[model samples]
Target: MSLEAYIWCAALKLDVCNGTPFRVLLCLADRADSLGYGAYPHVSTMAEQLGCSDRTVQRAIRDLTAAGLIREGDQRYVQHLDSRYRPTVYDVLTTALVTLESRGDNRVTPNRSRGDKKRHPGVTSAVALRTVQEPTYQDSSRELTLVTAQEVEEDQ
Candidate 1:
């Protein structure tokens, strides 16, 4: 599957996007299927579906681009997947640019008096929670050995 599909899927996991953006992502993926890999369909398709001009689609693409969710290329764009951490393209793109992340163990006390209707000045709440996912666990035997060695040394 193309990277756009993966991006759109992740975006949907958040409950904030509107219908137009949803249609943009959906149609973009459909067109990507026909256009094949490394093919970025013209913005008109999104325009046609959303009943807006190509400029609107352009802006939406720009927003996604600025958000680090996609990478723009020569008259086309790539999903700019973060495959090093996860197999899927664009896995948690938001986390990469996240300036601040507050989690269950690392909670950031919000300045409730500071903003009447705002969350944070620099960080999105969605990214905050995902930050606590922690590091990968790839070597169980190594961890056991290290713990055992530490225990033995401490005993001595």
Candidate 2:
């Protein structure tokens, strides 16, 4: 279970009068990974966990999909003895969070536009830059010598 996904799901402000869709979303988020993927529980499993019928769980899933909260993922086939059922996976879309943040009510407005005014003036200077000095050693005496860029260019 991914705590991050669950927290994000809990933070979502759904506009539903009934709580079934929100509960189902929380269940999916509980099974999702850190990236909000890999929630593939069976419909019956979710129904049992939520104390609701399979049809109710299915409807909740449909509602979430319609609301752009969760999306259906790839189906996995079972290869058990005489069993050939494909289970549907679900992925909690983080895009929903971005959409929520971009909404008119939730959007953050800047205090002022960039074209209004400048708080600080730009800095400009007309100073001449100097070349770095390099040190050289000769023999074991370890004498320190400083060489400037002009001297090195002249030698070259």
Cα-based lDDT for every prediction: 0.47, 0.71
Find the candidate with the highest TM-score and give its number.
2
Q: Give each prediction's root-mean-square deviation over alpha carbons.
A: 17.8, 19.2
**lDDT, candidate 1, 29-141, per-residue tens:** 55433222233555765587679998787777666556544453222133343433222112222332232232333222222243435455556677755765666778455
Which residue runs does candidate 1 get wrong by more than 4 Å? Answer: 1-11, 33-37, 73-156
- In the range 28-121, model 2's lDDT, one tens digit per residue, is 8898776566687778888999999999999999989998888875333222223444457787876544455467434222232344343432
Q: Record all residue pairs in model 2 with backbone atoms less than 3 Å apart, i.e. clashing.
A: none
How do the predictions measure up, each by TM-score? 0.36, 0.54
C-alpha RMSD of candidate 2: 19.2
Stretches of candidate 2 above 4 Å error?
Answer: 16-18, 76-85, 95-156
